[model samples]
Target: MDHIKRPSLSGLTGKRHSSRDRSKDDAAKGKQKRADSPLIHGQQANGAPSPASRPAKAASTMSIVIESPPNIFFGTPTQSTGALFSGQLRIAVVEPEVTLQTFTMQLLATITARKPVAKDCPECAKKTTELFKWTFITDPKTLRAGDHSFPFSYLLPGHLPASTQGMLGNLEYHLDARATTRPTPSKGAEEITFRHPLPLSRALMPAPEKNSLRVFPPTNLTAHVTMSPTIYPIGESTVLMKLAGVTEKHEDHQQRWRLRKMSWRLEETEKMVSPACPRHAGKVGGEGRGIAHEDVRPLGQMELKEGWKSDFDDGNIEMEFRIRPSGHVRPLCDVDSPTGLSVTHSLVIELVVAEEWAWTKRPGVATPSGAARVLRAQFQVVVTERAGLGISWDEEQPPMYEDVPASPPLYPQSTAPERSTSTSHPHTAGSATPAVARAAAAMNGSGDMTPVVSAMGATQRPPMERRGVTTEYDGPPLYSPSVVPQAVPALNMGGLNDALPRDEDLEDIDLGESMRRPGPPSHRNSAS
Candidate 1:
């Protein structure tokens, strides 16, 4: 009985040991199934780490932060270039110890100056020039999971374009930051990066592109002005103005038609209103309404001498005005505010001896010398300085509408697209509307293109009477192939055509074939 029992127990023990071996085999199979997993790269069935798979860098972390003012000035700030870009950058180690081998911080701003790609390839896009940039490296501080910060400030050059949003071929500005890191025992290989844009706005009001404007309702004056470019450079501007008498016939000889004195003055006006939020005004012991300051500064004034002395006149006065050294032309700006004030500028012309005929008049423009009949004409102009600012240009092409060749014959229209009197052709980018092309073509080839005579050029009128400063400003109809002389061969023709009031600079106007039947010399004042 004892021998039988011993054998049975031994057999039982053997069976138990075999069951344990089966369980071990199952565990081993599970391990085999997960052999390709990242977590099991060097682990065995019992979760023991493999020596070969035990590499460096157990864990790591990194981050970057930038601090700046609560608000950004979208207007020209007080600086050399009038651009104020300021902020602070912070580098930090947020996790597992990092042994920084090399650390760097870069500040960069990009501007897109995309001109039209090949006329046929509209899909193509491109950019050029680095608007602003700065770079520096911090000494490896062995950031033991702490932080580091750096401050930066820059005044972009004045000539730098304004910050534009989504305007493909226009000015735009943005900021970028990048960092490089080395791998460490506790920190693996990594990099920290951040990018944003510095908010800014520039006032670039292009001068009126329309060659001439007719002042009506308020005043009886037909005026034409020619600017080399409405966008005058560095405040160096020469304004040539011509005024015609478009008033109706009156009973009195003096009241009917005569221009005595014509004067243009540069006016700078600054106004400040109660801010919508007058939080500070109330604290200053004022009625919640804010304190205000307003001032109008007259830069300089020029008068056309012809009106004062001309013997035989059919009521036409020409004047050339210059930006005086003392004159200040403010940058054109449209600030957003319910009550905040701003400084503005304009060219104001005061025509004398026409009060009885004029529909509009200035209340207190009387001179002690005589009965002043002042009719006024006002125009806004954009002014800026280019000191220490260098211009950037693309190698392939110039940076303007006038620089490019004419399309559908759109050569002389050197203004904005809306103002350009060119035809819009589907194939070419510069062409304009169908009606414009037809009109331009007809005017270009025909002799019937008589001068409408807004403000006649040098070839038509005598040299402008110079009293103060000598200005070289000439009137326009500035054609490329010399269209003025060639287009109107009738100017050389005799009889009524000669005495039919000859004048250059019509700007494509059809008065009629028989200018001889003129009553008031029908005039048009284009305001665009």
Candidate 2:
């Protein structure tokens, strides 16, 4: 056979190049590809369009403006009438006119669990319920370029639980609004959504203080605890405790319990039912089934080795301490929701007591009997926000103008001059008479004789005229003027005469010196 020229297989065979040379070739190829393609490496070529060049999205936005005060339930859930929440939803349209197909808003309550039934499963983590819904636009409506507002008001049910965030779960409220708009009839509708958080709180009016008594069996020891009905998170709460029956008497020896140590802690407990979503319902058994979870943690604590007064004679121990919620822990307030979510708090106290023996004759000298007991007590406590000065919406005052003052205006002081009357008694150039002494005592602020003095100083009726009967008496004076004593000795009791007017000072004094009355007529004859 003639071998016409067997082609060399080496022409089709390849020789491997070094790693560095292969890398350089690859780099050059990538550069060329980037330069030739307009959208390569997330970069645009000179003639290619930029991201901003794409069709514009819907030129409309939505927002909410709360017009009413903060949402705060005034009293307990059973008694509260609920809070009124009013606000306006504003839609700003950039285009000249846009047709809105549907506009609606909803109030949603959501509960989220920190520890779900199934790890990494969102369906077992959160659940949301719609509380209320508002349909602003039922039919397609056209709005010109500007801002349009839709006012909304709702009275939240009083039975609903307040918003709460705990270690195990969270209860929250939100306002979710959506607006659907279509720029062109041929294009699909675009949705604009807005979400806002709504925080709610409840205040339980303070109630009477509570007193609890606990008696330990087999022992006469009794614990009396006094605590406030409601505890505030921001301020301090006082706990008054009295332990009695610590001392036991015997014929020969005395047995007594001595406090060694005491400690207290505030525990916060949270419970939540983690409901599975439709997709994960099989994991929790079936629909409407959920996994119950509970978490307990301490919000605050204190240990006391001392600070208690022990009286062996009285057989009692008294102690008082103040406690406040830990700021660092950010403890959640008490809440009980209808969605199987709840939070509560309790105060736990533990005391260590040891028994000792002492002779009745020498009670001060005692020896430990090596017998001890641990006394534990737990009390329910409410953790809540302070009920500030803010009153409920129903009790709020009517709106007042800015110029109106918070308090009523004060009236101007009286400008009329006061009547000036002399309080000093008048004197005569002689000893004080009985009438004068009484008048002087009355004028000296020691007695009240206004009517008697006015009658005595009145114009004396003519001796011939009868006083009450409109009849005439033409007879001489009933008696001689001599009947009136000229000089009566002044009273000298308890040096009171020094304060009274003297005989020599009578010249400057005038009896019946009132502006409306004339001086009394002299009883002595004019010649004398």
Candidate 3:
């Protein structure tokens, strides 16, 4: 029994070592388990760590700028037609500078007349709304700015007060700019917002009226614009006159049978007759020479859209008209003289644009309909009246078309050689000779034709002698004498009859000296 209990010492040692190794392994496993446990930090053992949360963002501010045209020449319109107003304005963007984005500009005229309180609303509210009631008598919002120019030209219908179809009143416009979030928007889609409207008075509104030409409504209807000098040669002085008419009237009569409507026409005529009366251009022959009717047409139309309701016993109705000729129409005198030509500018236009010229009955104060509002029309009536030369008034003459004679054809010299040759060569002594020979012939005759025999002075020499012959210088003679012949050679050569000097040559000789003193002949007379 004692020996069994003792067992083997080596086995006991192995068991102890195995138990120690097991214990160390368990301890290491326990440490790893504790480190991997989710309960410690409340995080998954193998999951990714949560990302750090970020703070929210705030709103941003964007800057915008707009550019527009300059307003230099606004409100100084030189012409106006009843309801037709001709003026230019500058339009541009402010805040934001020039950009590729184009802006749409428009002109608006809001008119408010009499407004009655609504019966439905409470009296207090109705009175308030009625007090500040606003109706667009002439809403010209459709007019857009042309290009990028500021205060761009705003061509608006002269007719205003649509309710009564009346002409625009002494009107003024307020200019402003607006920014839209969605310039190009889809239907039913929400658009981002940007600029509201900022007043651009300087760029949009009419400039100061300091030197502005006055355009009174109704009475002063037509405006004639004459550019300084001539518009043909640019920079040249032109006079551009725009003529217009307005028919406004208030009867002094109790019945007030005043003129209701008015319209005008333009007729241009030219005077062919020269104004040279009593002088060069004034002769009777110059009359009606170049007279003719050039052209005639209406410049434009303006209408009396509306006016004071009843046939007023006072005040005047004025129609306005204007003309802007593109180029030079006629020459102006340097000395302020009149050109002759009367204008029969009498083509009555039954105011087309203006339905009614004048209304005697009280018209409904609201905006007038198309037919009722327009009571009168104004047209540019260019009289084209010519001031006659001097102070006289010349009647305009009809155009005369005269046939002009055709010029004779010029034949080439080569086509008529005989005629050309005859003209070039006459039957003169030098005609048959070549230029060189002609010159030689002139020199050869110079001896017999010696001029002013004594005027030759010291340059003269005795005639040369030869054996029964006299040989003169044959080489191209020196400069020929331009003077008329005075004397001929006196040397006697008998057989040289064929070349004998004529009686004309003898007359030219200084016979007085020769006869006074008979000089001794150096050479004997030549024998045939």
lDDT at 45 for candidate 2?
73
Give the runs in model 3 whose Cα sits over 4 Å from its true position. 1-107, 112-528
Task: Tell me which residue pairs clash in candidate 1.
Answer: 214-525, 218-360, 423-431, 423-432, 423-433, 424-431, 424-432, 424-433
Instruction: Arrange candidates, best lDDT first.
Output: 2, 1, 3
Of the candidates shown, which would achieve the greatest lDDT relative to the real structure?
2
Q: Per-residue lDDT of 9-74 in model 3, one digit per residue for the tens?
A: 886776778878999999999878967765444334443333332332211122333343222221
Please state the error at residue 371 of candidate 2 in Å. Answer: 0.9
**Residue 502 of candidate 1: its Cα lDDT?**
25
* Model 3 weakest lDDT span, ten residues long: 124-133
Cα RMSD of all models vs. native, in order, equals 36.6, 15.3, 32.3
Decreasing TM-score order of the candidates: 2, 1, 3
Candidate 3's TM-score: 0.18
Candidate 1 local lDDT, 337-365, one digit each (tens): 22233545677777775333332243122
lDDT tens digits, residue span 1-528, model 2? 586888887765554446667899999998788777657443367436667676676678988999998888878888888889999999999988889899999999998988787778886788788999999988999999999999999999878899988877889999999988865765667888999999999887778889999888788899999999678877779999999999999898889999999999999999988887777789889988888888899988998999989999889999999887788888788898878789899999998999998999999999999989999999999887776786777667576687466888798796644321222223422443455556556563674444444444353546443566666554333533212232333233544545766556777775643543433467334523
When summed lDDT is taken over every stretch of 10 residues in candidate 2, the lowest stretch is: 420-429
The candidate, 1 or 2, that scores higher on TM-score is 2
| lDDT, each prediction | 0.47, 0.80, 0.30
Q: Which of candidates 2 and 3 is the stronger one according to TM-score?
A: 2
Q: Measured by C-alpha RMSD in angstroms, how accurate is candidate 1?
A: 36.6
